[model samples]
Target: MFSEKDFIAGQFNTIETASFEWSAPSNIALVKYWGKKENQIPANPSISFTLNNCKTITKLEVAKKSDVSSFSFDLLFEGKPKEDFKPKIQKFFERIEKYCPFLKEYHFKIDTQNTFPHSSGIASSASGMAALAMNIMSLEKALNPAMTEEYFFAKASFLARLGSGSACRSIKGQVVVWGKHAEIDNSSDLFGVEFSDIHPSFKNFQDTILLVDKGEKQVSSTVGHDLMHNHPYSERRFAQAHENLSQMKGVLSKGNVDEFIKIVESEALTLHAMMMTSMPYFILMKPNTLEIINRLWKFRTETHIPVCFTLDAGANVHVLYPENVKEKVLQFIQDELVDYCQKGHYICDQIGDGAKQLN
Candidate 1:
């Protein structure tokens, strides 16, 4: 929960329609967070780089109602009505209404669109929920103008986490740390914080997405996270993630590309490995996924380009490399790995500035 410093008593404006818009970027975790507890708390801490091009923009228009006891909202995606999203949005509002009593006093019109496809292994939920949380906090700020800008983001992260755990990390820029860690102070299970003390070389990191599969997943991330509850290796995976985060923190700060590549790739494979070993196993990686990994390994070994691969919960790959070696890496990607991708397509994005409010 946020402290008094986060927000003061609200004074709602009489304006019939108050509009807000915010854009938030998706992130790829370097230290993977695969499992969680109830209330969206991660089993282990994770760190990620906020992406540049892949994002979600959301516009919310609020019309105050005479009664303050009922919540009403309509949602649209890419300007088309998305009736399926209403239940999730309703649950989100219900979860956050305790912290924000004014929620029930308004009828909301939300227009959200993603720069990328849904369920494309890009973590669209992270950016989407973060942007929605940002828009809500924007209105909260209007009601209580005394809140600090830092607290504004903190509150947004807090709210977003209630919707999606990874969404909390999307609220911060460059790099972000979610879940509490002993090495970092002020970290919380409730919100993510910007992990800023890194060497300049790391700030310009690159992630080229290899779209191996564009179709919907056989198992949703929600199901994957749920599977971890009864997973035989769940405890060991949690401890392993903690240990990996400790090692990678030093590697990230020192800009050790070699160690960074190893740790990140390991974490990615370990994440999928956990899924495969679950009670009722499921394989998220395709045969092409393995082919791309082999190609990446061969190319890196022959050329010494320091290229590496990481997978989300889907079949696609996120090729991680330093900015200096981007040209060589991209050339290799085109000549060799792109054939494995769906439609030979990919998205080039880097660590980016965090969520921004347009209005």
Candidate 2:
């Protein structure tokens, strides 16, 4: 088990200036994590497929400074100064300061950009925080040259989780598991771990994001997660997540696409159901969201295409299917589902191998 003491850095090598850049992909949870505890600890275990095209690229420029009292940083998004983003970054720095102690010793300039539209329900936090965490870890590695590759990634994931719970899964590979489960090896609530024993049939799975609504959600994820605290069915939902994860593990290993579809779709609906049944009873899904889902169901039923849909705390629909049926499913989407999207816009993505440092 890793503790706060383990991640604290020792004496660092002297450095005048350093710059690092990274791109991290967003992920879609197969077993959704709805609630949280203190310090971003998840109420239930979750698994996700790291996405390819939808990502955030972040560049960090760090210079040593004499004043170590507080963190100093300038922030930019897509080449424009974004004052509203500073508070979130400031909070993230505060949360991770103990783990990465060198934060206060440097003045940072962060320039970030996202491949997909921000606040459009694509989980910019996951990719953005993961990219920023990777850049921070790069500086840490520069200070401590002896750090191993495994430790670097594990600690990066740990730091990312401090920023956003789902961000931890964006740090590594085609499949990642966050939060501890009895069956998964090396799984921990502290950081996400890669799941590498997946069957070939699940490899390169396609994910087409249908933009049901392109505007910001009415309720933020933090508020939605908090509602679970007083939710009547929170306990049952957490338990169901565990059982579904176990079943998913078997389905992934055995290459059962049919069972995979069932579990994935059920988990997505259960996530929203929790929101609808909460105290405030808010719904994130739009009319087009349901239309797209129903059309997907009809298409899948008639064609037996094995395609499925999942939601990510928003009105957008993630249409998932195997590589084998890409042509048919994509055709069905273009012919039927594109009209439901905002401005006929959608992104075609696939399972990816997590984040990577840029040259």
Candidate 3:
């Protein structure tokens, strides 16, 4: 918690310049934790490792003002101003107000940049929401240092979900959890778990991003989940998801790459299965998507090299392979997947560091 003397309320005037920045990596979930209970919370607990190359860097500043208690941000896409994203900025302001009511009294200017493309299915939402939440909370801490850092992150993540579902996972460490399970009140106590005990296996992993396409999805995750609920197979899908969750935890806990590979591949397929079995029978996977999956399997079978694949609610496929085997996977992707893959679809890597303060 920050201290009162340090928490200069209107001290926005005394401090000429106050700034903070953080570079947070994107995360990939081994056990696809989906479905929300309270305000887009997940049904079961899930774990993920933050990726290395893929990340979002954010910086914020506060200045004393007289005219308007306003907020603005320079949103960019591929290095160009993205004024169309103003609504998202507005939503950030609205959400922060709910947490730190005092924010309504100050004028703020936020600047954010995404190393990854916007809405390209690379967890851009995760990075963006994390940066915003952390930056604003930094401001609160500066004013009144009494706030606990963990509590601040948790509250920020809890609110960030209003902006995006996956943002909750961004609040924690190298590994994180999403859903009500992460919430303290949950009886299950199966919240987000960071793998702190073991020596990190993914620290050196590098991600070579493969940006298949930036086109929006035909059906949003929100709509897709609704369809799943109404689908007659929904109940069965939920049961299978529960089972997969348990298996994924075991595979990761043991650090058995072989078992981990099996669990990830199965979980990816199962997620698609749930999607396919939806009442209306919508298919999120494109022909190219299937080709990528097939290539991964063939590469594994032929070369005895192992790589993992995970997909969210879109066509983009995240390929996970070790640094040692990267050349093999890269060559294989170039030969088999390049033609079908989008011009810019190649991000590769493993787990990454958690969120923290930056100068």
Candidate 4:
């Protein structure tokens, strides 16, 4: 049974307590979501998986109050207070109010924790914002009782987008599509397609996270997106993402690994291509970044392994290889790429699960 005890006094009443727990999984872009409209609307719809290892657990308790007209929350990262994160939290609240005005009356206390390192380029913001948004919806249901699950997901995703572009997809399960194309207003297109939907023929496909350099990226995603407006290759990059998403969908539907690798890898390169062409010309690739890529290509040519490499906004390299050849692929990375990598670097994990309410 769930508890509905009251812990704080309210203007309507006093000493009321109720709490709910929710978990949100991190996501990896099978087809990346890049560039955005004013206020962070995605340029094109993109899909991703909910990761198992990277996630955030959020608990929220809402108290009714007539005297106090504001909502408050305390945020923590790995059990330590993260005061710097408050502005984003406040912005999230404002976005929620814009969409769900009923929440304006209730005061809230929120607690959140991440399972992975916040500094890791693992998209922790995606999972964290998703968890926070979902928990807010649960509290709304307790207060009004009329909020439907779909309503929760819709409003929560809208809130999540304000926190981070990738966070929008983490609000749902499995394969989530985020952008206006998915829905006219703010709503997810589907609950998610099953992980097996990726294509049975590609069961051998796998990804390796190679930390070429742990130093912070010079170009942040936010800055990168803004640079697209003036980038010489922006149009090409946009067209590539569109084609990549369509091609990846076909590969999933047809179980085509060959096409999958080609599209995913090319799309990643195209994204970076845009970054390099931006005004003032920023290059994310360090010497080690190029070395790993160069070695991976060489190894693929010589060994004939079905392998591909993709890079996100960061310098880390995500090596895609066939599952049967995973050991060989890992060894190649260790022998050829590990020496160039920084210490305390490069951890690997597979695709993960979506967000869920926890008991």
Candidate 5:
């Protein structure tokens, strides 16, 4: 168990200037986490597959400042100054400054870019915030060289969660659990934990994301999470998530692909269902989203491919399947599903180890 004091940095060795770079991947939830409590804590535990190919790479350069009165930073996206993104970064700094006391003592230059489209519903905030957190931890590790490897990643995930709840899951790869569960040892509400035990069948899992609609979502995930506060079915939904997570553990351990498909697809639909039943009642899925899903269902039924779908908080559909069926699944996606995508746009990715340090 960790508390706020565990993360507070002590006196640091004097450093004039330093730079660090890291790349963090986005994750797709199998058991979705919808609501939250105070301080970005998840209302229910969730598990996800860390993704490859679609990620955010961030480089942080810091110079010591004479005045430590306020946090100062400049943001760049894809090598271009991005003023619009400053407010979010500023909020993140404010949230994490208490944990990382050196924030106000340095002027930071944050240069970031994404492998996937910026806001194409690929959880850019997750990857972006996660990458930034890893870079910050690198700087901290330099200041305090005695920091252990375990504490380093755990604190990094802790900081990432303040920026975006799901970003915590992006810190570790293949499988990660984000909320505290009785069955999952060492799980916490503060930071995500890597799930090491798994059936070999889950290794190298494939995820082909179909871009049905690239536009920004009608209702942001933040607001959607807020709605759960007063939702009539919120308690039941939270309980269901816990049960689903337990079942998922068994499914993954036993290599039950058919059961995996059922749980994954149901969780995706349940996520959207929560949105539609909210007070304002909004739908993020486009017509093409439904078309692609029906086609996927038909393909899976006729071919018995064990392919399934999961969703983030957007209209994009993530097609999930085992690696052994990669060729057949890709062929099916191209033949029947590509037309439903936006301009036939899709990204082929697989499960990957979490974040990596560039320098």
Candidate 6:
């Protein structure tokens, strides 16, 4: 129930040229959240694995100016000014400006860089927004030393959620669950909670990204989310997600990779199914997408290697497996999946230690 009126700002005022950097990982959703309510609220609860290597690092350089005013900032990407990203940042600031009282007194120069390229089926928004949230949290901490650690992360994830719903989960740990779920304690639609009760085996999982199509999706994630409003199976999809989420806790805790593979792949296909059945009826998966899937199934069967594939909204496939079988999976990727990827490019990543400050 916190509001703008609750914040008490205006302390020490002579601060100048404070900079903070944070790198946050993109997440792969096991139970995909396709739709949303107002305020970026998810239609159903979703769980995801926070990835390493595939990340966005954002540096915020701030200098104090006015005591209390609206947001004024310069935005850049990879040391270059990104005019395309400004409007989105502006809108995001507008939504959460009231909460960040420190934002009013400082001018932010945000420079962002991503490890993976754009429109490459990686959740850049999640990582970028999460990094930005951590940067702002850094600023707030510098301004007010009294802020508690629990509130610090809660507010950080809360602010990130205003930018991107998935970004909320990115601010947490190895695995996170976003949205209100009956199975989890203290779960809320406001911010994500880290999946703490996981088995040690699940912690070392690897995600090998097989890039089927590097190009942008025909239907943007925003449009796809909007289309869920009129989608015939929206209700059922949400229900299925809830059921899957309840089951996922068990799968994760018991280290059930088999059930994990089943639920994860089913969720991936179901996400695409919703997209195909949308009013516009478009498909994001390329021919190579299916080819890679078939190859993964065949390879898993023949070698008895525990490898499974789950897809995002785009055409790329994320080949997920335990770290113990990394050698076999990488060999399979090079031998079978590489040809299907655009220009034979793929990325190898793993479950990360969550976002961190880069000093």
Error of 6 at 48 (Å): 0.4
Poorly placed runs, candidate 2 (over 4 Å):
none
lDDT of 5 at 150: 92
Model 3: per-residue lDDT, tens digit, 296-332? 7888888888676777777778787767777887887
lDDT of 1 by residue, 1-359 (tens): 45533443355554566899999999998898988898788988999988989999999999988887678988999999999989989999998887777888889999999998775666688899999999999888787777788888998998899899999999977989998888866778889988887887787889999999998899988899999998999999888888888887888788788999899999999999999999788999999999999999998898888889988889999998889999989999999989999989899999898899887
List where candidate 4 sits over 4 angstroms from the true fold: 1-15, 144-148, 180-197, 202-205
CA lDDT, every model vs. true structure: 0.88, 0.93, 0.64, 0.68, 0.93, 0.88
lDDT of 5 by residue, 1-359 (tens): 67668998889987999999999999999999999999899999999999999999999999999999988999999999999999999999999988998899899999999999885667799999999999999999999999999999999999999999999999986899999999998999999999988899899999999998888887899999999999888999999999999999999998898999999999999999999998977899989889889998998889998899988888999999999999999999889999988888999999999999998
Per-candidate clashes come to: 0, 0, 21, 9, 0, 0
- For candidate 3, the clash count comes to 21
Clash pairs (backbone) in predicted model 2: none
Clashing pairs in 1: none
Compose the digit string of candidate 2's lDDT tens values, residues 1-359: 56557788788887889999999999999999999999999999999999999999999999999999999999999999999999999999999988888899899999999998895667799999999999999999999999989889999999999999999999988999999999999888889999887888899999999988888889999999999999999999999999999999999998999999999999999999999999999999999999999999999889888899999999999999999989999899999999999989899999999999997
What does the lDDT come to for candidate 3? 0.64
Give the root-mean-square deviation of each candidate in angstroms.
Answer: 1.9, 0.9, 4.6, 5.8, 0.8, 2.1
Poorly placed runs, candidate 5 (over 4 Å): none
Deviation from native of the Cα of residue 60 in model 1, angstroms: 1.0
As for TM-score, the candidate ahead, 3 or 6, is 6
Across residues 1-359, which tens digit of lDDT does each residue of candidate 4 receive? 10111211122222356788899987767677667777677766676655566689988777666754665666766667788988888887775565555555656667788776566665577888888877866765666565566656665666677778788777765556564332222323322223335556554346577777666677788888887776666676666666666666667768776777787777677767777777867888778878888888899889888888887787878787667788998888778888767673676655555678996
Model 1 C-alpha lDDT versus the unseen true structure: 0.88
The deviation in Å at residue 69 for candidate 5 is 0.9
